[model samples]
Target chain A: MSFLKYRLRMDKNVHLIMKILTVFSIVTILAILLGLLYKAYPILKTHSLTNLLLSKDWFPQKELFGLFPFISSTFQVTGLAMFIAVPFCLLASIYLSEYASKSITRLVLPLIDILAGIPSVIFGIWGIILIVPFIRDYVAPFFGKVSSGYSILTGGIVLAVMLIPVMVNILLEVFNTVSRGYKEASLALGATKWQCIKHVLLIKSAPGIISAIALSLSRAFGETLAVLMVVGNVTKSPKSILDPAQPLPALIANNYGEMMSVDLYDSALLLASLVLFIIVLFFNIIARVILRRLEKNNH
Target chain B: MKFKAKFIEERIFKILMITSTSIILLSLGAILGSILYKGLPSLSWEMISQTPKGGFYLGKSGGILNAILGSFYIAFGATAIALLVSLPVALYINIYRKKFSKYSNLVRLCLDVLWGVPSIVYGALGFSVMLYIGLKTSLLAGIIIVGILIIPVMIRAMDEVIKTIPKGLVEASLALGSTKTETAFKIVVKQALPGIITAILLSFGRAIGDAASVMYTTGFTDNIPKSLLSQAATLPLAIMNLVSSPIVEVQNKAYASALILTFIILFLSIISRLLSIKYTKNKSH
Candidate 1:
């Protein structure tokens, strides 16, 4: 009887502990949102939304805080990187799901995992020594006369390389989940293997693929050190892909050391990060909803 | 001669597919080939064991020993913290609640969103929170933020492993009159031990390799962190600092640091793979 009582008491303690930890996860999420909001309070209170988001002036030393350039630069780089990787990811995903043999799938998939696991700093290192030089010497000259290696094109290419594996992994999963019967029916109707994949699988899984792209876009939007290393960290809006531009993340990373030196600089920068956090979070949630629908369709 | 359109289309697609697949392989090959080509020559015994002296960024003296040790310290501490939070939350979702219940799904959904978030965003949040609390960039802040960053990964991975445990085994344990708490901690978790190890290894790999999140939360210092409040350097940060410098020797050292970071992630990958294989073996019993 005593042993039974002791066991019950122990179970009670464990359950309480487990519940607290689970709740703590939710707490942390709220804490981060509130913290960023609190830090951005000054700008959100004083500046008009359009002025803060769309103005071109970003001179911190003079106290004018405009986020138009950084926000546009973020989208521009993400758009370029995604544009470059999407077709390759689409084709490779189809190949992985439809045509690759088990041995090849087994081999290629692990390699993808390795590529994904390699850190961003390594990507930054590669960007500085290899991609930057290649861009400056070979690619940039094609665009016109450009002196430095750092620009939007350099940032976009590096981001594309970093994000392709992520896109392929998610898209491949979506493609594989496509109903086998759809393909079989297509082939039975005299469609060729490629036709079956193209008409049946690709059209059916479009939403999932879009979500995968959204997920990758979220990453590209927030990528920092690699972009900072190659993007020249310029403050002005980029006139062309060859022009160096600063994204929100790169701006925050480069200026945090000196932001305190300027009035309202810290508040504005934190506000920029707040905007970034909320945008990325919003995109991620949309991707999840689409992904959930895809999973539901499969089941 | 009229060619069958379907046949021609298939042939063209076959070519396109091969080209696209090769693109992936080619990109991987280029990154690895260049990193190794530049990094291998500069690697040395002293580089791994000594701290930076004056003008280390100029490539004149000392080693990355402090950064290496600091990286190990932060990652190990962060993993330990993440494990404490992740295991219980994962177990609660799997064992304490009805499987795939609405609450469990909501938590899983939240975790999925967290998983897709970029590391730099975490850094931004960490930086803000540190300022709010009047804390400087220190090892403690780095660990706290990183521990938070990896919680979703650890929980989701562990949940996946636990979810794969056969329902029959769980039912049998309940039929034998074991307590839910006992069954969870002793039986369900025991069944998922190999997978738990894999989860830990992967999260450790993530914590150690991430640079952006620590860029602001853990400011770099040449010395090892003496206390949690002390500033510490990390390998990825060291690589970033070195490669950005104008000195040629420092650039070479950056590659060596990358090689070491690569080796650690590779070792973690290999170990996790072996552990997952063991997980499959255990499942058969």
Candidate 2:
């Protein structure tokens, strides 16, 4: 009877421990959700979501906190990055999935994985060392002498490089899921290899590719390190790829540490974050929707 | 004639594919080469072992010893706390699927949002809360922020792994007259050890690489942290500090510190890839 009682006690202890852990996890999740809400509250309360989001001036120093410049810059850089990353990621994915021998894929896949592992800061360093100088000396000079120093071109290029691994990795997963029979059928139809890839494989994987680009674009928009290093951190509308401009992330990161007025600083930082959160949330939802639609179509 | 055309087409396709793969390979090579070339000249023992002092150009007077040690302390502390919090929740949702599964989906959505939230946002939130709670800018605040930052990653990774443990193993253990607790703790978790390790490693790498979130929460103090609440710097922040300074010597030290951080991230990633490969192989078998 004592042995059975001891066993029951042990079981009870484990159950108790599990219950506590569950409660802790729930509390942690609640805390994060609450934190996001708390951060978003100031912006939501002070500004109309439309005005705050669409206004052009980001003068936090004077407390005119229109997020338009930041939003535009975020989109511009992300747009530029996607322009660069999509083609390369697609080509690489094609190579990995359709063209490369098994041995070659094995070797190249891990290299891409390593590229993914390289920290953003290192990318920033590389941008500073290479991209910034190249832009200043060569690219900017060709565009008839832009004044505001670090150009959107620099930020865009650096962001493009940083996003390559992410795009490739996600697209590779999608490519791997392409039905082998589709490829075989296209081949049996006497289509050229390029024609088959262009027509059949690309068409089938289009949704997945879009999903991957959406995910990568979100990452590029939120990217702080490389942009901070290269975007010149100047608050203005970008005239050309070579014009200096402030991205939302660079703005937040540079000012969040040093702002003097509590309300101004908190409100500005929180507002930028809220904007970033919404942008990311929007992309994530789109990716999920597209992926689900693809699944349904396939089924 | 058709056979010859097919063979040539395949050959040309193979050549084009090989060429494309080589471009990615070459770009990666160039990036790494540029970092090493720019950074290697300044990397040294002294740079690794001292702390930064004054503006740039003061030469390699201080090392990253404090930052290196503080990084490990905060990362490990946060990982331990996050794991303690995340594991059982994963298990609970997996085990009592019918009773709590709705909440699990909610948890997952929260995790996804949390992951998507920019690190700067996390820093801002942590600053407000930590200051409000009187933790101030200290290692404790940094650890807490990092712990929060890593929770989503940990829970997601662990949940996927734990959910994969075959139901039959747990049922077998229960059929031997074991309690549910024994089936979960002794049988299920042990079977999922490799996955758990992967989760921990991924979170660890994330914590180590993090900068923006911890920047405000842990104010950059050059002194080594004497207590949990003391302000301390980590490698990422230290590198940032060094880079922003105008002194050439300090800039060199910054490069060296950047190299160190890069190497650490590289090593961790290699290990993660190897572990993932092993796990995949095992699953296939």
Candidate 3:
């Protein structure tokens, strides 16, 4: 009886410890958000948010830190990547989910995993060696333009490749979740396979598709190393795909080492990262909510 | 006429889908092919064994031994730390809380948000924390930051594995007069061990390959780090620095470094895949 009591006491203590550790997970998130905000507050205090966000001048030596160009470049590259990647991923996922046999999917899925696992820096290297030159000499000339190759187009191409595996995986899962009965019902009406997929599977999985895009957009936005290597780190706002541009993540990655020495530089960079953090957090929250709703509806 | 148009549309869309799928597969092949084609020629045993000599980026003859070891040290340290923190949290949710409970859902939500937070943001956060604590860039700092970055990944992966254990297994263990803690450690963990190992290796691959978070927290160094406080170089940063060199030989060296990293990640992925398939046989069906 005494031994039983001792074992119960030990179990209670262990349970309490586990409870505290679990609460620490919540604390970690708060710490990341609050810590970033605390460090970024000084810059937010000194400059009006609009000026910091809207102005093009970014002479950090003179304490001028406009972020307009970076923001524009980020959106242009990410938007271009999404434009290229989404339709391709949608088509590929449809092929994999609806049309392909099991063996073909088995071969393709592992390939996607390998693609997803390739380091971002290697992707950057590949961009430099292949995509940049391909753009400069081939695609750009075909478009009646000349580019040095380290341009938004190069970055977008590399980023699009990086986004492919992620988007395909999500889309495949989403497409697979459409019930077989619905597909059969559509087919029973003498519809072609394509028609059944277009009218039934696509309509059923629209929310999942939207969430996948949102998730990958957040990923492309926060992507640094590959975009940094390919996109010429020019501070000017890019007016065309051929023009070199600097995005926010690249700005932070490139200037961080020197940021500590410059007055308000560290804060400015911190603010830039805080911007990235908040936007990504917002996207993730929306995606999560939509995905949760999709899961609920499926149930 | 309507039937003809419908038939044509089906043919067209099917052709488009096939083309897109082929494009994706071809791009994957191209990426792998280019890396191997460029990287293989420059790779050498000496390149893997020797530290970078003076003027290493200036076409000097040297190897990336320092970076290779530093990457291992940081990845191992970070993975160890993450596993300790994540295991308890994963266990707590599955064992202590009710399934699909509000509190557990909230914790899961927090982890999802954390996972979405970018690596650069984590780098900035780590840099700020270092400033607050008056610490310099070092292996310890890198490990700490990467550990934080991967906690969500490890926890979420482990959580899924733990959740997969049949409810009957836990009930049976408890019916045998064992406490909840005993069932958690002895029964549930035993079944989840294979998946837990896979999660560790996957996160290890992530931590090692990551450059953004460690670029600030772990300052680059020439020689291998002599201590945890010493600045440590990483393979990705080494590749990044090398690729910018004007020397053709040095640029080739960058490719070789990337090849090494690729191999390491590939090896880890395969090992984890095999381990999961091999050891998952005993799981409750």
Index of the highest-DockQ prediction: 3
**Cα lDDT for residue A29, model 1?**
61
Give Cα-based local distance difference scores for all models.
0.86, 0.77, 0.91
- Poorest 10 consecutive residues of model 3 chain B by lDDT? B276-285
Q: Go through the candidates in order and give each one's DockQ.
A: 0.70, 0.47, 0.74
Model 2 scores a TM of 0.89
How far is A154's C-alpha from truth in model 1 (Å)? 1.3
Candidate 1 wrong stretches, greater than 4 Å: B281-285
Give fnat for candidates 1, 2 and onward, in order.
0.62, 0.45, 0.71
lDDT per residue for candidate 1 within A1-299, as digits (tens), equals 89988888888898999989887776766676787788888877888878999999988777779999999999888888888888888888788888889898888988888888888887877887787888889887886767488888888888998998889999988987888888899999988898888799989998998899888888888888888888888889989887889999998888877777777788898888888888888888888889988887787
Interface RMSD of 2: 3.2
Which is the better candidate, 1 or 3, if ranked by DockQ? 3
Candidate 1 clashing pairs, residues 3+ apart or interchain: none
The DockQ for candidate 1, computed on C-alphas, is: 0.70
How would you encode candidate 1's per-residue C-alpha lDDT over B32-138 as one tens digit per residue? 88888899999999899899989888778889998998899889999999999999899899888876888888888888777766677788777877887899999
**Order of the predicted models by DockQ, top scorer first:** 3, 1, 2
Residues B98-153, candidate 3: write the lDDT tens digits: 75688887899889888888899899889888988999999999999999889999
Docking class of 3: medium
Give the distance in Å from residue A289's predicted Cα in candidate 1 to where it truly belongs: 0.8
Report residue B8 deviation for candidate 2 (angstroms). Answer: 11
Q: Is candidate 2 or candidate 3 better by DockQ?
A: 3
